[model samples]
Target chain A: MTQISLAKCKVDQLVKLCEEFGNQEGELINVLHKAQELVGYLPREVQEVIARQLNIPVSKVYGVVTFYSFFTMTPKGEHPISVCMGTACYVRGAEKVLDEFKRVLKINVGETTPDGKFSLTSLRCVGACGLAPVVLIGEKVYGRVTPGEVEKILKEFN
Target chain B: MENNITLKIDNREISVPKGTTILEAARELGIDIPTLCYMNLKDLCIKNAPASCRICVVEVEGRKNLAPSCATRCENNMVVRTNTMRVLNARRVVLELMLSDHPSDCLVCAKSGNCELQDTAIKLGIREIPFAGEKSEFKVDLSPSIRRDASKCIYCRRCEMMCNDVQTVGALGAVNRGFSSVVMPAFDEALIDSECTFCGQCVAVCPVGALTELSHTNRLINDLANPSKTVIVQTAPAVRAALGEEFGLPAGTSVTGKMVAALRQLGFAKVFDTDFAADLTIMEEGTELLGRLNAFLNGDKEVKLPIITSCCPGWVNFFEKQFPDLLDRPSSARSPQQMFGAIAKTYWAEKMGIKREDLIVVSVMPCLAKKFESERDEFKTNGDPDVNYSISTRELAALIKETNINFMQLPDEDFDAPLGESTGAAVIFGASGGVMEAALRTAYEIQTGKTLENVDFEGVRGIENLKEATIDVDGFELKVAVAHSLGTARKLMNELRAGTCKYHAIEVMACPGGCIGGGGQPFHHGDSARIKARAKALYTEDAEKSFRKSHENPYIVSLYEEFLGKPMSERAHHLLHTCYFNRGKEIIEQ
Candidate 1:
């Protein structure tokens, strides 16, 4: 069983955020998005609070959260790295670059480093196939990446 | 704004929409312009224009190099010779180049007869490859529900476009460049390790055997050879409607009994029906819907509006990834596949006096998503998966052929008594709006305290993506909504959020036509055949049935009386119902 604890200060902050976005109705998704941003993930305590504040069921909130790809409930690392492996990128060896990142990071895609410095993730084609082999470090896009460029990319992130 | 273009294709002058591609105009004029990468209007046109394959070249008047029709837009007055000598030679050259690197071993490949490449070669009358090059050597990926053979890929980008743009789960893309270009997941990660739901949409669109469903019948054969495991097979409601296509039986032919007999001939210990669990799902879900409605009436704090059906694993996964906050609203009742596993492990194990672990539950479904659903952590029953294995309808047909079973001569046999027995309400579980209709059949009866003379809720049954109905039951009018595809589901959800539509209940299935038209079902040119077949079989099964409603299912009544106490009872809620958590910002770490 996963033990859940409610942090009063954080809960109050989340409640204030929810109130800022119009208490109920369509505010469920808005509140959830802000909660995820604040807590890194939509933890159970935050969901329960949102459910109570919105006067909606926890199941409904969970269903919406689970149905969308954008939502995540777990804590993330300080720096997140997402590599695009779309058709154009794939044709140009984006996969090999990703493999080098996995090897260098000593962590698989979707896994964060033990020190919490970086999290590596792979995305389907980001519609940037023309560039071939593109990697996104946060909002910045690096096109035509080689396997050898992975170490330099990681150093920049750190 | 009114720029109509008249094009002469094969000597017929036809008017087409302004800016229509030459291929589209040609299609309207009933002229065939063969293309590998051009799939209708969906994919990117001809891999960066001027045609990479050059197969669709047509002799447009005054155009040099025989303009590729797919890339060139229609002009005001175009004289196109679709079947000229120059066009034929150009198509032949293109076919020859495509076949150069392709494996000549088409006879053994899964897509041998169905491959578009082979069909194009045959059409172009090319028996030999003129330009040979170093063929890419790649091993087969026998991952979860799909197989990948990169060596056979033509770099058509059909699968890539569909996966990234259509489904939006970009699991596969081109890796490396130039001669070494290969389509694969990032870092060569196993597909099972990614977010792929194994919907098989990519497989359906693939022009060659580069993508296929992973086959597990060999392991089944090995298990059959071993004297230890007691293997029992169950066919989903959708499989019976589509499996007949493999045989010369017309699509939608009710081959339920023949399907069972075929499995029995293949030496299975027992042949069961997933429709039985589909009935069981109705019993559980129908009662849950009533309970939720009652809770709302009573002003319960937990107001989970529009309880979504969680039967389609693909839809469930889609929701889990995209709408994690709404997970709690999904019906806690496991899908017919998962329910079959739970019942087979618990009740069937007790009835057979065999250890639950010893019974191998093999499911034949019309879906590739079931392959992934079977591996979900939530599906585990007492430490082991309730269902041991799941095989798609196509793979099962392949297995029957591999085992040298005489499917034509097999006599129809009945499914095993207790667990095999299902109601008409269950049979419709294969088609769209089936779950809602099944639930309504039982819920109306339960709520009204009177038998529903007409079990068929005609208003809710159809192939449309979204449907709505207002039923007057015992002076209470219930508004219901049904949506099958994600696009439609999104529409309904948006409407609900905007307060534009208010309904007591809403049913949404991820696929277009429910399980019958699932991503894992047989690849049909169009859904008309399979949809008609499934709909006809479901209604026919309903008309011929003694019990047409879930409430009338004696097994369900007895199960509730013996153990569950009642529908939505405390124990039943604990065992049959489960809570969902919001995975808001957590990436599903594979």
Candidate 2:
């Protein structure tokens, strides 16, 4: 079996975040989202613990985790970049930005770097058409990005 | 209508039943309130209760934050503005968020024109999305009757609501929460492995291409490529009446001959008619009905009550699900579609001096459950399934286009002899109350031992979900009830369960308006087109054919004389008639 690391600190932090929201009973999804955000992915163990605390079945937790496209159950690199490829973003050259990310990292979408420094993924339009070709790296939204700007954007994350 | 509430929608006040949602009231007032989760009236009351998707948000004068009109009950003197800028902006934002994770494959997606999400996007004039998120990647669940792609789901819960509330087959429900919430069967099991009846009701209600009908053309194509196989195709009665709609023809255009020509161009060895077997079904079912009536009148030892019609597999499956205890009430006649398959593999195969295995039988039907029926263990006569592949009417049109068949230029041709000729009674089987009408036409004459002056049972003909009629024949009053749609059938069944409904026979079809509005039929905007097409085609087919009655068909009479000996004969009972088992356990196990 392939051994996977637990995002233990991030999981505790996410549970606390859910508690802050005053949604203790209804915070499984919120906690999962925060956990994914902190650790860059939601591992199976994180989901299990969340399921237990929430009094929801592990299978139910896994089903929701597997159903939505927004949730990832694997580990991400130190820095994660998501480029918007939604219809608006697509028509406005988000694909070019994505291609640039693929070239700079030498890794496709959903791939992490060999050195575990950076990861890339494509997203649907992020509702910011005015800021077409938007790229999000660790809560920072880089607007009006071009293929030429990808290397510059990555250096900051590095 | 004692407790009606009047509400103002877009400046127009309309009085609707109390507890009517703002959406329903708006709809009643000719005010269009855009909704993602709502499907007509039936979807209004569903658990999880229109809470997930906030797209149907509308503004009320006194309400804070946008209210989902689908969930909010209408109040007297309530002023609802559906087209306000705030409501539009909120809807747009919600749509943008939903689209943020959707796959960018609409060009090749099956739901391109018919997709609600795409329609909403275009309607909202949303040029872009602002949120960047990870796109969900999922493998396609290509089961027998439906395909599921979780990647495209907006999770509006329309399908889940329809499955749980309307059909009451809660095979699907939301599994996870926020962003990760995916609708799936229990334990993420394969749909085919689940108790899913493959009714395609989920597909019919799905807003996006998240759910779709599985293509059977690949298997048919493979059969056509094999030299050893003699592939024979049969078109259902409703298919010809509606296949033309997909080709830009008007809704009710009867393209029976053109359909035959199109099939010939597709290179099938023989193109038969399910209508022929429909006539055969009437013979067997009619006789069975007569036998049951006789048994009941005589107080026979082994008598089954009710004698429900079994022409619709969806209804059969529904009965198996909700009314397992009443399985014996259903007549033992195999559906005409299944009977056609059995006869094709047995009688036709023997007549042509070909082994049943070498004969590839394909049925084109206005139903998706027929796909599941073809796979049923009871449908098999020889070592293999009688029907190898079942394609929907829309799929047939797609296959025709795929082969580049010139549908317009093809000359009208008759179906192959012996198994292709069908009576007018068989043709009308596509519409609601058609089975009851056909059975009455034949049974009246058979029972009274005299030919009736007027063969048309006008009392039983129409588009009503539940119709009751009593005919005086040979000084005996024969009472019959016809119900289209499982919801309506449930109402009649409740009456039966309450001992209030007493009838000699009844016909129940699972789909509303019978096979014409079947889940497999072309997507009409509303019931008007469906009802018009069904009514026109049914009456036209009846008027055109010489043999308007089932017993009057020479081919059916010949079939009974040559092979089966007579209607309801021991051989006929073996091949055509079947026994119903309590399917509550079977469905759960599946």
Candidate 3:
């Protein structure tokens, strides 16, 4: 998934993305993909704009957007933190590492800080089992993460 | 048959289509397989078998784990065990888990007797709360017509399917995830804030009390008890054909006489029929159609052709929100319900030597939108509504039972005069193509100045999504079209927007089978056969009537001559006619 924020595009850009898919009913998935690619998220307003341009119901768009986990309605913050919770990482001190990050960030998993500077999310294996407790901060991978290392990693973004 | 697949369930062999699901094949052999989240409504083209509930899981011979019968398609030589020890335990466990999270207060529940989950639990012989956990509590949303009690929701997704697939309203949807998942409007907003047409289709298909009609029974009961107020009730044509189902009568049974008798016993001062006003509607709407047709024929391009019928409140809200630019295309005459309310409160109230404020007109309808329609400010004077209050046919049945009135044994009765007389044309306003046929019955004869040999317009009579028929009126071929359900209306509207529509008039009802399948009628439990039966009852009533045309009704003729000068006259326009406003932004004459 493209984790970086692409919500910088104008509202009209999402409408154009839907029209570029020929506004066909069968191309709903393709149109949603292109619109999400431009807007980074499918908020209710963006979905309504796309629904009008595609001549489809907003509920239909929402159904498709929700059926797939790759789509998100809320925009990711500037620095989204990920703590791997796969079998390899969980056997290690990944649970402690995730708790430390939550304590330092003062936000639960799948939540963004009030300042929008950082987001805490959990993921499965990133195929980097060598570093059992892996943490990613905005596309940067940190191997062999520790409970005490969470503060240092968050400071790197601020 | 081609591509036949043989399957065996509980040692019974059966042959079915290749794509038939295991649940369906088992049903074909009279083997009942339990299900929770499966709803199939073919008439509206809505089938919701997500199989997420897992209550219909069955054991396959070779498979290690059980498979959902609803989703698992039958294969040739497939061996399925529907009621084995393991399958029974699994179904019971699923029900227990669902009940653990669901509220157990079924005594006061709105859908106490009709809930599918409750029936299944009883069939399973569940008695204890073995598992207990935190229940998902959601704030109840009570709109003008529908109630959303998310705490009672089983995540069946029936309401979601109806809104998304059938009506295309897109108001209700799945929100959140995991244990907190719920069906709600976009961003979890209230339904009134969303594009909900208040068609009540969601309430109709819901198998539990999660979704239900907001009861107006209490307010009406209080009104009926007040001696200072004169409470008069009007019954819709569709209500008489379908209300019988609530009283243990068959689906197609017409209980018109019994319904009138029950209304009288309920202590109403007067019992009226909205069909009388439906005939009045034809007089006004038929006149409007012919005037537009004549104008278009005389080379007047300013008048919009294909004058749409605006009798359906759901259809009215639809075009206002979805097709605001073409609001004037529909007839400005108020619906039969509204017309009866306006005339009863004004014309009849004056004839009875009473003030409009002292008269309270209650309507028993097969619609939920009629509740919202009566609340519109344009149809009110000094904050008093034209129709004081409207209740659904379901609510009326409950009131009858509450008052200890045995509906089955009630003697036959007749409707009061002046505003209670109707013709066959008015009785047909309940079905899908009934309005188009009624208008054609009168418009054809008036345009040709000759009697119509065949009053039944067969072309616009079935449950087709869109129907087209052309009538030869005085050597003029008047092309007309009819469509029921908002989704189908979208297609016809698109053709009109493309400038490719060839019809001179169109009739649209938001419900699939028109008023008979209304959101407030007795629940069919997603059975289209019941809808067809109700339609048959209305047609049968029409055939039995002495006068089959709107203009031929003696009361309507006297209504025009004694009071209103003629159709579309200044007096008729003031009492019977109304206007449409752009309702896209939700500023409903605020």
List where candidate 1 sits over 4 angstroms from the true fold.
A1-158, B1-7, B12-33, B40-54, B65-78, B101-108, B134-142, B164-166, B170-189, B493-501, B526-533, B569-590
* lDDT (10s digit) by residue, model 3, range B1-590: 57589988999998897899998888878888877788766675668899889999999999999999999999999999999999999999999999999998899999999899998899888998699888999899988888889999899998888787778778888876788888888666687767788999988888899999888999988988899999999999999989999989889899999999999998899999999999999999999999999999899989988899999998888888788888889999999999999889877898899888899999999999998898988889899999987899999999999999999999999999978889999998999999999999999888889999989889999888789998888888889899988888888898998999898999999998899999999998868888889999999999999999999999889888888889999999998888887666321111
Better of 2 and 3 by TM-score: 3
Writing each residue's lDDT as its tens digit, candidate 2 over B1-590 gives 66578878888878888888887788777777776766553312223356567877889999888899889999998999999999998898888888889997999998788888888788889898998888877777878678999888888777776565555555677876666677887556677654465667777668789988877988888888999999999888888888888888888889999998888878899999999999989988988899898898797867876678999988887777557667778889999988898888888889889987788999998889898888888878655888887999878888888898878878998898888998888988988888988888888888889987787788877766678999897887888899876667877777777878788799987766678766677775433445456668867978899888878878778777778998878888888987765554210100
lDDT of 1 at B481: 86
The list of candidate 3 runs beyond 4 A from truth reads A1-9, A24-40, A66-70, A84-89, A100-106, A124-158, B1-6, B17-19, B42-46, B73-76, B585-590
- Per-prediction DockQ comes to 0.04, 0.06, 0.20
Point out where model 2 deviates above 4 Å: A1-158, B1-34, B41-52, B56-64, B67-85, B134-142, B174-176, B406-411, B491-501, B525-532, B586-590
Full ranking by lDDT? 3, 2, 1
> Each prediction's TM-score against the native?
0.73, 0.72, 0.92
Best model number under TM-score: 3
Name the lDDT value of residue B403 in candidate 1.
76
Please state what fraction of the native interface contacts candidate 2 reproduces: 0.12
Residue B333 CA error for candidate 2 (Å)? 1.3
lDDT of 1: 0.75
lDDT tens digits, residues B1-590, model 1? 56478878787888877888888788776777788766642211112232556778888887776888888888877888888888898788778866887899998898888788888888877867879788888877776678888889988776665565545555666655566666676445566654455767678667789988777777788877767888888899888887877777777787887789889877789888888888878878887788888788789977776677878877776666546656766788878888787777776788789897788888998888788777767767676877777988887887787778777777788998667888888888888888899999999988889988887788888877678999988887888988875656757666765667688777877655677766556676433455556677777877898988877878777776776687667766654555554433231111
